[model samples]
Target: LGGGMTNAVLALAVISWPKYARLARSQALTVRQQPYIEAARLSGCSDTEIIFRHLLPSVLSPLLVMSALDLGTMLMELAGLSFLGLGAQPPAAEWGSMMSSSRSMLQTAPWVILAPGAAIFVTVSLFNLLGDSLRDQLDPKFNPK
Candidate 1:
């Protein structure tokens, strides 16, 4: 069921979308209970305005941060599927598949395996750090200083 980038992307999106949905739902629910929302309602803000102006902003920040964090995980998952021959067929170059195909060379030419592995490591680490930085910057409660 895999040979192209689109297939991998669709698979990952299908698998990961529920997490974001749940997060949005929870954030909305939490924000709904805040005193400011109550005050907005008391001051005659319509439901649509309350949602657009207040709830959306409150919920979107966490979602963006979560999406940033999920990028690395999704990439790893895509690579894993490719390595297992379930994603990104031979024509498509994927780090996991590259490493998988080079497994036999581990003893004779370890660099072949090491190169892709190192790339995956660095890429994943950078994504994770990006997510953390986003969280720190976006979330009001987090103060890195």
Candidate 2:
């Protein structure tokens, strides 16, 4: 069903689609200019074959890194939307809603506010760290010990 968090999900996807496409297209353009791709074309390889066999593999790493980063951003955005009453409905246990619902109790009970806030903080931090690690791993100059 296209209810609940679905609208936020769709909205974010639509909003971010252009950025993803531009990144992929730039990567593809760079990859295409590599000598190997030119050689593949000279060898009578079809466009589809060149794309699937060569370009996709080359572009996938950066896309994955971007996706990992975006995952965290998307989580935060969903939570923000939920807080604004545009995402998850009442009585649902979404972190943003939890924070929203707990706002009035902020002074009386600090733990209520702390819980969802901490969850969002930890999750976003972990994802950003994971993305950074992935980027470092993908870099040829990066050495892991």
Candidate 3:
């Protein structure tokens, strides 16, 4: 329970944190300049109130989209680490671990590698698709139809 899972969690956090921070920073900077935000500031809204009430709502959509996209990337990273013996430690059923352990079986039973490879491909593709759909649905420009 603590081995592979912990490694994966740590890897994912290390890999994904920077992208999220950048996204939030950029979004907050842009949203902070919007007319409503400026008006709120001029009208005596506290910084905390402006941030939580106004800034967050505007920036949250992109955060959601990026988070969906990050999930797949993080999973792929975990699998790659597992394949390299750095993640999802032995005995775990992660696709990368499966692929790594089944390396010797590649010649005799290609199906073993194929199954995990296919799973990783499909799962990552699905996550990317979900992220794209959410981006389109949430963005005002994309939603206009």
Candidate 4:
């Protein structure tokens, strides 16, 4: 509908929402069957209390990891949209736009095209690594033993 950064963000959010929703739903379902949840129920805790005190904490780690991992995907998607002229306006500085604008110079000043491409690669790789490290740090099964 609209163009520019806000539109790009909304598009990314729309694309991302379903995955996180499914993940949260599955995590909550698993947590719901845990002994602590059962104990909380036996202790007469309300659903809201149990959800906030138990389910949320139990599910937050995985969600954090998912969000971290999704960042790179979102960034790439936004960049692709910008490259296609469907995202950030001309005035806005975006790597994809930079690459797109320099496309004609590919045979002349290849660095113009390569620089943004390399930047995108490095940034995405860093974000993926960040997600991996976050998962390692947060997952209980990551014991170095």
Task: Work out the TM-score per prediction.
Answer: 0.92, 0.90, 0.89, 0.93
Give per-residue CA lDDT, model 3, range 7-96, as digits (tens). Answer: 668867976688789889999999877899989999999999999999898789999999999779888988898898778777777889
lDDT of 2 by residue, 1-145 (tens): 3447889888889999898899899999999899999999999999999999999987888888899988899999999999988889877889998988889999999999899999999999999999998889775556778
Q: Please give, for residues 1-145, the per-residue lDDT of candidate 4 as tens digits.
A: 7778888898789877998899999999998998989999999999999999999987999999999988898888888998988888778899988888888999999999899889999999999999999989998878765
Q: C-alpha displacement of 15 in model 1, angstroms? A: 1.9
Q: How far is candidate 1 from the true structure (C-alpha RMSD, Å)?
A: 1.5
Q: List per-prediction Cα lDDT, in the order shown.
A: 0.89, 0.89, 0.87, 0.89
lDDT of 4 at 9: 91
Q: Give, for candidate 3, the lowest lDDT window spanning 10 residues.
A: 1-10
Model 1 agreement with the true structure over 1-145: per-residue lDDT tens digits: 4456678788788878998999999999999999999999999999999999999999999999998888898888988888887777777789988988999999999999999889988998999999999998889988765
Candidate 2, poorest ten consecutive residues by summed lDDT: 1-10
TM-score, predicted candidate 2 vs. hidden true structure: 0.90
TM-score preference between candidates 2 and 4, better one: 4
Q: Judging by TM-score against the true structure, name the best candidate.
A: 4
